[model samples]
Target chain A: MLRIAASGDWTIAHLSAADGELRSLTAGPVKAGRAVIDFSGIARFDTSSAAVLERTARLLEEKGLRVEFEGVSEPQRRLLDKIDTYGTPDTSKAPPAPFYIELVERIGVTTREIGEEARGMLGFIGTVVSAIGRTAANPRRFRLVPFVHHMEKSGFDALPLVCLLTFLIGAVVAQQGAVQLRQFGAEVFTVNLIAIIFLREVGLLLTAIIVAGRSGSAFTAEIGSMKMREEIDAMRALGLDPMEMLVIPRVAALTVTLPLLTFIADLMGLLGGGVVVFFMLDMSPGVYMSRVQEAVDFWTIAVGLIKAPFMAAVIALVGCRAGLSVTGSAESVGAMTTRSVVRSIFLVIILDALFAMFFTAVGI
Target chain B: MAQKGEPIIEVEGLMTRFGDHVIHEDLDLTVNRGEVIGIVGGSGTGKSVLLRTILGLKKPDAGRIRVFGIDLAELPEEERRLHERRWGVLFQDGALFSALTIAENIQVPYREHLHLSQELMDELAAIKIAMVGLRPTAASLYPSELSGGMRKRAGLARALALDPEILFLDEPTAGLDPIGAAAFDDLINELKEALGLTVFLVTHDLDTLHATCDRIAVLAEKHVILVGTIDDMLRSDHPWIHEYFHGPRARAALAGK
Candidate 1:
């Protein structure tokens, strides 16, 4: 038998220094059929290093040597026995897949996920539409208090923020348009440019984006947390239709509020354009208002207003769908909230582009 | 073995209050090394508050707490951290980081405190997962994927990651079934014997106390009213103490023991 003296502090704090020596002992040429590890001089031991020692013995035994511990203290022996009886550690993690294979796998997964998401969203929209229709037919089924509360929260509270953002955007458009048009001595047309853009596109799209971020995110978070806490299930257990109780009020409020907010945004945007034209192009408010009045007909404003409720419906539907899909984790609530905002904004922009194309084709 | 009277934790005249509401006042308790001490109390008695106070998680209103013969409040920040590594705490919920896997959770303390290599840490994490009665496959799972009992076991494995000298458990067996709770009690007993760990357990599980505790400390009237073995508890004349030990649940626990 070959003897190995395993001594000193066999604890976590000292294990790093002893690691190489212990490994060399295990890997060195074995002159004898058996090896005895003497532990009489060990001043301290702990579970951390007991794991290391147990591993070292296993390695030695696997190398065709009979490994035995000798002269361990009572406590050390008990620890060793405990570690020995515990199952072995799994040291090998499977290797990752190759890059091209993983890339193909990811593309397939993403495509499937997008398809499922589209199907789920369409189903949710149908459910919300039916609920709205039911409440419309039977007016008493419409919850008055919650509808009023939601209008106040998702509509009235959003007024100042929406007005301020659209005003800034309108000012920027006036300033940039004046600078560009001045190159051709057409700076006087800045008012006409601002009027058409704000009424036809900017007012409606900007308000939709803001509300999607603000109220839409709130809707997803509220319902997602409710789902997480099992409150949604409780509502069903109490024979309440969550669609009517929660979804209809919030969606109807958004649909009503988005148009009103868009109208206010249109006014604030024109006021901002008037102010910028007065300072930058030396045009008075009267001249600016007259130019804006002659820029387009009722079609300019009607085009933007016509898209408001559709955008509202899409945003509300996306938010509620994300909320209802939340699983039993706090992390899922955050992830779904983000998804709601992003998807709503993306869908709103796509709908705006499609509306613009249709109106141009029909000579609006 | 540690000497009979070697105290690892000593709390004297510890007072804790939340604004005007006093949770504990003039409380005192001593926990000897290498023994399991169970703290029991009524609903509002603040058994967990005492544990938190000793662990320095909550500031005491007025008192001194000494752990390992040194007052933690008097130690400088760096030295306090060194002492802090000697003890570990398991909260009522697993409280595992939701983002990390079970193996990564167990390696958190090791990565923070030790200079071990990745392979060594992985091996250690696997051992801890198995030691806590978790299957090897659970190493890759997130805490949210685990059942309540499994989460508690994973929490225990994380607590033992650094080979702490003292383990503090707050209601370790609270949500587990009876069989799971009894197995947990046996695991604690076996771990204490093998590693010579000093345990500070705060729980209402009478069966756990009967199976694992070296002594029981009863908290009442904002102080430790009694501290002794179960027999000493059965002989006490204090009204709350009498009711607690002679209760039907206590009789069943004692009979089972």
Candidate 2:
């Protein structure tokens, strides 16, 4: 006789232990044909156990044994009938390709997608440039109201946050510099370190990141929703230029406002550094100002200032492009808005690095 | 045959109001066992609200609802769950959980209400998927991947997971094409016969009423105005009822009759 051992409370509560006992049977030997599984010692068994029973029977059959139960309850027998009808899941569609081959295929697909995105961004840039030219040719057609509105939003609204953040960054830089320089009796040079660093890179880069997070995402969401509602198409149908009416004012405002915001951020950073110097090293404000004036070069300020328009262009273009790419779904609007902020901030840091390398190479 | 036993669901003096707006007042309904009752209404006639109140998803200002002869307010929490487990509801828009696959969606009620293993649950889900006429491969696909009709079928499969005696459908044919709607009607009729279920279908589709419902309940003003066969709906003299049954869509639907 083929022996079948069934034990424990055969339910979902005891599934792990029951399945364990069932798995152990696979490792050992069993004869082919008929087997009686005893459920006399089983305390309780439910539908979950019926599934285990079915699986156990299938496994036993694979080992060339036919299985039957000795003492199944009425309910369990009915549930067993259900399990017998459903059979097993078919995993036929699973790809049998090698792992490395699939990995390479995925990489290829992603690279092509990135290439298409880059091409689309380039096309948007060309359209924006032509739109800018058209605005320049007919200056009176420029919308002053919306331009001012955007400036107030992207610039004036950002003042308090930008000021507060830059102040803290500036303080950390001055404190760190003073700690290192004071060791060599050159604590006075902390002013030069703060001025050069903030003017050339830190203040402007931080501001760009903040603006990308705040204003860039807003631009994407605005334009994306308009596209989703078919308002952009409506504008086009009514002989309105979306580039001039929507894109131009926003881009123009960002371009003009970013430099002003950067200049203010630089001043705040200097003030923060001075406060840190005063408290930590007993450095006087008078001495700090003279040092800053001495170390502050026109090229340093011009470098950061010149980069502002380019950074603004990057934010506006990426934001608008992401918006324009939105299809019919509201989900697309959300995705594009997030992409707009992430891409703008990422490109800003990269462009800043390029500027640093170029300035150093040219010995500016 | 429908009136052979006591009503499975009974609603008496049901009143629903939102702030100053009254959606329903003194509404009464009796649904017998093993019958499909179609609810019809104009826009803002609170057909969905009545379904919600009956399902206990929404609380009315004042009412008495008896499902399976138990007062819902008096039933204890565990007992209430037991009663709830005996019924199933399909909402409009096929509210399938976005994260789970179609099969997994069907398995949810089973996982919660039954003591079944992962294998059994998976097998049962696959069975439900096929029962709803979806391809076996569709068991692994997410709700977002399915078309509108497939989504509704998946939702129906999930509703049928627990082998519920009572099925609640909200506008089941609203978004489907004419052919798909007819097929859905046939599926409902088949399932009702095969399972001996009492179906409460809130619908505006006149064709569906002719095809599937054993009785039509017309809601007007604030309460059920009429409850009878399609022939009785034709004989009703109420202005709203007269215009609705004699409307172009209704005439076209009755063309086959």
- Winning candidate number (lDDT): 1
> Can you write out model 2's per-residue Cα lDDT over B127-159, one digit (the tens) per residue?
667667788889889887888999999999898
Name the top TM-score candidate: 1
Off by over 4 Å in 2: A1-99, A133-146, A225-246, A284-286, A327-334, B1-5, B71-83, B111-115
lDDT of 2 by residue, A1-364 (tens): 6766777666554465656667687658876679888877677555446656777788788888877788876655665665566675453446679999999999999999999998988998999899889989999989999999999999999999999999999999999999999899998899999999999999899899999999999999999999999999999999999999988888999999999999999999999999999999787899888889999889989998999999998998898888888876677899999989999999999999999899899999
* Sliding window of 10 residues with minimal summed lDDT for model 1 chain B: B1-10
Q: Per-residue CA lDDT of candidate 1, range A1-364, in tens?
A: 8777877778887787677677787778766488888888788899878888888888888888898888888888898888888758886888999999999999999999999998988888888888889988999999988888988998899999998999999999999999999999988888889999999999999999999999999999999999999999999999999999999888888989999999999999998888898899888888877788899789999999999999998898889889999999999999999999999999999999999899999999
lDDT of each: 0.90, 0.86
TM-score of each: 0.97, 0.81
Residue A238 shift from truth in candidate 2, angstroms: 6.1
RMSD of each: 1.6, 5.6
The digit string of per-residue lDDT tens for model 1 on B82-144 reads 999889888898889889999999989888888888878888899888888899999999999
| Chain B TM for prediction 1 | 0.97
